[model samples]
Target: MDFNQLKQELFDYCEEINVQKVGIASTDTFDTLKQRLVTQQAFNYQSGFEKGTVEERTTPTKLLPKAQSIISIALAYPSKMKDAPKSKKGDRRGIFARASWGKDYHDVLREKLNLIGEFLEEKVEGAQFKAMVDTGELHDRAVAERAGIGFVGKNCNLITDEYGSWVYLGELITNIPFEPDEPIEEGCGDCNICVDKCPTGALVQGGQLNASRCIAYQTLTKDFLPDEYRTKIGNRIYGCDTCQVVCPKNKGVDFHLHPEMEPDPELAKPKLEPLLTISNREFKEQFGYMSGSWRGKKPIQRNAIIALAHYKEVESVDTLIHLMKKDPRPVIRGTAAWAIGKIGREDAKQVLEKAKLHEQDEDVLVEIDKGLDFLKVHTTT
Candidate 1:
């Protein structure tokens, strides 16, 4: 079969599989992306979730010896929930970002890529294709941009004309010499809303991100969150969407293209109180399918404690006190003690004082002291 005919066939199959967009790119080295990676490394700006070395990420042939083209695919997800439940006062809820709203996109994208590989295998005899999603060495946004699927927006997300930046990206490298699509020259122009509205100012002038300062990256960390971002994260338990939410390109773009991408109102915005006490088995059963649960329950529970404190919910103080006194993990214990202080219920000082005497961990002791310090002059409610 000719290259154009194969591409047309592949596009048809992509439509059948519900892939929102598909584009072809050449196997040229990503020179601009390499320079940016070098700068990011020099400045200590990487989120540490990045995989592989710089060369492995930028050079396509390194991953596939006879690589002639790359196939990029995008799947659109919902930006708003249908009957989204609100996070009320006593029955407060913590939110998972839209990316983690449904079944893990990594699994969804990988499954689709594998199916594409099967389609190509049937069409091109003895064709070799290697597929990957977000966890892959090759930057999905860079590949998608080169493939003409989208332009990398100032938020550093691949923004498609149809789906905005609300699409999950994946790609496969193939030996088939398919015609490459022209990269979009359309730009963000003077629109700086995403950069200006980053909650923690993680977005630099031209889309470079200091991942260390990003709340989205901070949410996945297992340690006690930094003091600066505690209030900034608000009720976000998994990731932050401030950048995307503020972008003009993303306005009025809420696509429910895939059933698996739909958010379950309960799991996506679970009651903060129940999450604080969710057992390992229960947590896995309830949230294992969601991408946000990859770091396990520790960070989510800690964030839940912080969200409760954010509301100054006196009712949650009892749960926080239990976590402070009994939770084995120092991160959980320390964070809970801090939350108890922030809540400042009627018995706050007394409870913190009791825990201070018995806490063995120096870190936990420090947090307990911090809690007591909150009650220095002002009386508790």
Candidate 2:
């Protein structure tokens, strides 16, 4: 069987299917990644969202027996939103990271990977394959790097020359012995923009990331954000894109290839005040299709409250009071209390005092105290 010809055909098929970039790599244990992951765990730097053990993540053979090769694919997403709504004084809007600007990437990439798998099955009888997107056991970026799709940038993103870092990556493990493509030999060199500009110093040194401190990871957490990062999160309702936005490699690298990947201006940059009281059904209806909504409305709502505080939007004060008093979730209630304090409106002290009288949750009470403290300082000055 002429495997080289088959590889060429596969590449053509990928192009026809609108896959932006594709590359192949021999299945090999990722020694460097394993060591880094182990060290990250030791330092408590992991985001806790990682799916599997370090061994399971680095060894492809463990996922699919007789895995001879891996095929990596990238789909470019739009960096800049078209006709983005302005965040006015009373009606401030929060930004969703560019990665979540459109429809969920996992669904889009999975469809492409399934199509590739079907193509492989037709070409070779008894062909076996396993496909994975971002959430899969195998680290998609590591697989993409080994497959010669792109070089792993200092920002820890797969930086392709064609689309820059504004791309979603996925991979397929297969028994087919396709000729491996040469790995990209590029490096970030002396540029330290991403690391230097990281809000919370999540990027330790260069390529290493302390996910716990990453605003992208922090935005997805269900608990109250750490005090240090609360102000740092800024107006981001979902993920943080500081590192990627600062990368010199990503300059002028916006692509609107897939229609499904286009952003809805209102949803991607929704008004902060409206989000505070958005019903569960409404939240799902508007944001369910985006990748950022995977963690559900709690985290997003919590972040919205923080965004209102960041803007000091006094118009949102009434809604914040309602959330602090009436919200069933303690995290939301506590976050609202904190945001109310951070905003420090004239009536905030009175509202917090009323809620404090009945607030049962210890965490909520702590946040209420914080609100009162803000009022105390405001009164003194």
- Number of the predicted model whose lDDT against the real structure is largest: 1
Error at 179, model 2, angstroms: 0.9
What are the runs in model 1 whose C-alpha is more than 4 Å off?
377-381
What is the per-residue lDDT of model 2 for residues 194-289, given as tens digits with 9 covering 90 to 100?
Answer: 999999999998889999999999999999888898879999999999999999999998899999999999999998878878888998999999
Q: Can you tell me which runs of candidate 2 are displaced by over 4 Å?
A: none
Clashing residue pairs found in predicted model 2: none
- lDDT tens string, model 1, 43-144? 999999999999999999999999999999999999999998988878999899999989999999999999999988888898999898999999999999
Q: What's each prediction's clash count? A: 0, 0
Error of 2 at 138 (Å): 1.0
The estimated TM-scores of all candidates read 0.98, 0.98
Q: Where does the lowest 10-residue lDDT sum fall in candidate 2?
A: 271-280
Worst 10 residues of 1 by lDDT: 372-381
